[model samples]
Target: MSTLSIRDLVVSVETEAGAKEILHGVNMDISSNETHAIMGPNGSGKSTLAYALAGHPKYTIDSGSVTLDGEDLVEMSVDERAKAGLFLAMQYPVEVPGVTVTNFLRASKTAIDGEAPKLRTWTKDLSQAMKDLRIDPEFAARNVNEGFSGGEKKRHEILQLELLKPKFAVLDETDSGLDVDALRIVSEGVNRAKETTDIGVLLITHYTRILRYIKPDHVHVLVKGKVAEEGGPELAQRLEDEGYDRFLVNA
Candidate 1:
């Protein structure tokens, strides 16, 4: 089984004042078909960990080791990391004005596979995925995420996850801004990916509602850039009921 290992990962970002560290010595291990939910308050370095894993330039890896299987992910470029089976679904998906959804998906698929997908097969897969996600077929011809609603953009992110079929996906607050129906649709897409590809997921969120749809194998609570607590699925329910007050008071 594929494993994504994070060990003592410390990451920082440049600010006007100076470089400020965000993640402080975090460690976690996720394997194929395992869903690890990262629940934390705002500024707990949840997004930092996601971007750090995806090799975002803004988040500098001060020290630590992140590996996919045995290869070091810290040394790889962002695109190289994608090719290495790491995918990050951004919290706020940016719009690509000139790139249509169809073209962008095909291009990304080719990049990760190092070969283009056959047209007939690719088209059918794309249509089915979009349909399953409740995305309108016309969305394919539109520029990627251009003028799309919050739920639409989120669905687009999952669409890529379904088609690209990465070994691991770090979903950074994917449930944010999604309504009940949209959330269910998006969650189903993630579940579909896991079932079909055995994709490992690092699901970051503030609520347990999504966990109801995509059950996590493990739950981690982050406070002040450190993992404050870890447990099984029950931990998520505790967080939902108790909130992060205990963790915050202790932090």
Candidate 2:
């Protein structure tokens, strides 16, 4: 089984006041087939940890190391990290104006795999994944995320997750803006990817509702950019019942 390890990770971002640290010594190890949920309040560095793992230029690694299976992820370029089997589903997916969804997914698959998927197999898989996500066939022709609703954009993110087959996925608040129906659909998509590929997941979210559907193997509460508590799925239930009130006070 592959492993994604985060050890004492310290990350920062530029602000009007200059460099400001966000994540403070965050650490976790996720293996294939394991799901870890990161629950935190707003500005608690949940997204910062996600983007830092994905090597976003906006976030700087002040110290610590991220490795996938033994290779240094922090040393790799963004695309290089992706090629190394890392994926991030952004909280707010950006619009790619001129790129059709079909073209974008196909090109991304090509880039990561280093070869174009055979036309027949590629077409079949693409059709199946889109249908599974309940995305309209017409979406294949539309520009990536352009003019799409919140649910539509989120579905498109899962579409890439399903197709790209990454080893590890850090989903940044994917449950946000999803209605009940959309939530179930998207959750199913995530579960499908995990079952099929044994992909490690670091799911970042505020609410425990998504946990009900996704069933995290482990739950971590991040307060003030640090892990305040860690436990099994029961921890998520407690967070739901008690909320982060106690943790915020301690933070």
Candidate 3:
């Protein structure tokens, strides 16, 4: 089975004030058939773990290891990691000027597959994916993320997840800024990807609303950069009902 193992991961970032630690001794495991949710307060390092997994150069891995099956993912470059079956849906997708959505998606798919997708089939798939995500067909000609609303940008990320079919996806606060309807659409897209490909999901979010639609198999409460507690969906319910005050108090 394909599995992602993260052990005692410590990460830091450089600022004008010098290096600032984010994730500290964080550990988790996700299998292809599982969906894991990480819930935490603001600045509790949930996003840090996501960015670190994607090999963002800004986040320095201070120690520990991340492995996919038997291969060392921490040693791989960003593109290498993508080719190795890793995907990260960023919190804020940036604008890619002068590139159409169709070309961008096709190019990325080519990069990971080492060959171009069959034009007719790729077109059909892209069209269907956009329809499933409720994206406008005309969006194919627009530059990626340029002039797109927040919902549209987030939808594009989920669109990539569906098309790329990564072995594991780190969705960093994907629920943020989405209204009820938009959140449901994006969550549905994620569920579709996971069911079709058996892709493991490392979902990072502060609220449990997204969990209502995604239904994580495991829930982790992150506090002060480490996992303070973990359990089944029941844990998420408890956190939602009572809030993270207890966890924050301890921290």
Mind giving the per-residue lDDT tens digits that candidate 1 earns over 161-230?
9999999999999999999999999999999999999999999999999999999999999999999999
Query: What value does the lDDT take at residue 153 in candidate 3?
Result: 95
Task: Give the TM-score of each candidate.
Answer: 0.99, 0.99, 0.99
> By summed lDDT, which 10 consecutive residues of candidate 3 come out lowest?
40-49
Clashes of 1: 0
Estimate candidate 1's RMSD in Å: 0.6
Q: What digit string (tens of lDDT, one per residue) describes model 3 on residues 96-127?
A: 99999999999999999999999999999999
lDDT against the true structure, per candidate, is 0.96, 0.95, 0.94
User: For all candidates, what are the clash counts?
Assistant: 0, 0, 0
Give a tens-digit lDDT track for model 2, residues 161-235: 999999999999999999999999999999999999999999999999998899899999999999999999999
